[model samples]
Target: MVIPETFFAERTSLLKASEIRELLKWVAEGGIISFGGGMPSPATFPRQQIIEAITEGISEHGDKLLQYGTTQGLNELRSELKNFMEWRGINVSNVDDIVVLSGSQQGLDMFGKVFIDEGDVVLMELPAYLAAINAFKLYDPEFVGLKMDDDGIIMDSLESVLKELKSKHKKVKFLYTVPTCQNPTGVTLSVERRKRLLELASEYDFLIIEDDPYSLILYEPIDVAPLKSMDGEGRVTYLSTFSKILSPGLRLGWVLADARLIKKFVLAKQGMDLCTSPLLQYIAYVALKRKVIQENLSKIRGLYKTKRDKMLEALETYFPEGCKWTTPIGGLFIFAWVPERVNTKELIQDCIKKYGIAYVPGQSFFVDESGTNTMRLNFSYPAMDEIEEGIKRLGQAIKERL
Candidate 1:
């Protein structure tokens, strides 16, 4: 018997496999130097501390942890998270304003479910996070791409887009951004631009989704602050994860938003997973209470900074003239633009087969279908030698294509 496509939901047709995950499968088979996934370096994980936390938690509270938790999340973890957010300068007046998630990825899906209506305008960066572009697409919203420079989303372009949309009477549902050390591009929104973005949101009467997974991983001392901290009108919904600071395997994340909005997310989440794992939430609480997560951050920042510098050096020495990439101050990726003639999507399979190197092609990250000559490379996962060797192989592939 054969299964028919019609048997599936109509929305299943909109689903597409993540290109980064597909590349990861090839990397798992060996012999590929990967710059595909935004994976944290294993060295950064506080293994001994995590082991101790798990042992202590299970011994002290095994009976409570093994049972199912509340739909909102474990109360102890939520209280700890409130304090954690405060340390980062985000004020949370009550624990009810936060909801733990399976991962920040779940929060993205929840946003689509709770907020989006078909054909509602959802603004995005020119080349935004691929996973976010895919997540919001399932809701059938109209995605409007905004232009960006090194400093991040250009306010002029945003102002123009808002005015044009107003003329057509199209109100944006929300503007989604990975503002600090943004994925795919690694450019941070400047403080001035961040202020202007908030002003524009207020003027246009729209919400802002600030997906901030990389702010804590900054390699340099910058004066930037989380958008949620600056939000006086409660217009920004902030999402962050333990994936960068701790370990991705635990799969824990949280969202801070208005109490009403969090209530909706909790309702939506009840249907999705009922609640995030109680066992994992306990581990995170222990990590925070012991100050293990904070203690490990400096080491993560130092290690990633060295990798970023090495990759930048390799690009300068090996990549051909006219090829350019961002000098990321932090984060796992360095997005690059090859000569206009080289389509990275067409070149990826060949790169994997012949050159033994892998990077995420940039086209899928663009909601507008525009970044054909670009790619995003991860510096945090591969070894130092692999960073240099992979860049050499990638440069050769582009040269041959040219």
Candidate 2:
């Protein structure tokens, strides 16, 4: 079957398979320890609690649960989300500002569809989420990568780029950031930088997409707030999910944006899925209403923190002198850098084939594709023992390569 590649759209050629998802398959086959994918531990799922919630939800609203829902999502779920976000210190002035998504990933796609014109400028962290790069790539955007330090996005670099864009008379569509417990790097944006980010967005008249899935998972008492919380101008489109707090299988997430954009999101999503599942929304609604998701946090936090600690300790003990990594106060990942002489992308196959450990090479996460010496490691899904052994094996692989 020699099917012509021309049969597919031109944009299809731009897409690449996710290494993390591919590595997950190897992890599933068994003994390999996976530091791939932002997957939560199965131990975090409240099976009995979820089962009870599902049973009760169906018993009460079986007909509705089985029926198609509005593209905007369940009203009760949005209502619950409002209160929930309030508890986390993010307050919305109007209920109309909320739109439920299948997951935060959908919000990313829809943002691309509605806002990105071909050649429109989009800003991203140096090493951003690959899935996001894939989603927005389909819309034909000119991506500009932002540099970062421990405080997250470097404001000087951001302003210099903004000035260059202004000189070129180009308007940046949005600056997408993970902010709290960022993916790949696991660095939380500092409070001052967050404030400066909002100020810069206003100064430049560009929107901000705050993709915050890990803020609530913070292990420390950091006072950093979601960019949306401090957004008085309503320039930030905040996206979050129950994937970390509850379960990914439920596939429920929501957006908090200006009503103007919410209207567009509803229209765009209507063509996409018509609606997110009523049944899945019901599951999240039940979890929120019953406080199961909230109550489960302490346990999820404790378990992941222990695993994160173990992995950090292993890195210190086993990794080579030039190796360095972030110590995340919270989040599923610990991003690391090996010596510049070692390319983690080239090293991964050997690590998996010989060392029985798997991780996502950091190159794909970079919009500019420059992170060959880096890799992203996950601590949430792997057991504590796996963390110790996997890191030890990874260390040896790097040492041997060196």
Highest TM-score model number: 1
Give me candidate 2's TM-score against the actual structure.
Answer: 0.98
TM-scores, in order shown? 0.99, 0.98
Candidate 1 C-alpha lDDT tens digits along 203-247: 999999999999989899999999999999999999999999999
Q: Which tens-of-lDDT digit does each residue in 80-133 have in candidate 2?
A: 999998987898777778999998999999999999999999999988988999
Candidate 1 lowest-lDDT run of ten: 49-58
Q: RMSD, each candidate, Å?
A: 0.8, 1.0
- Assess each prediction's global lDDT (C-alpha) against the native: 0.94, 0.91
User: What is the TM-score (0 to 1) of candidate 1?
Assistant: 0.99
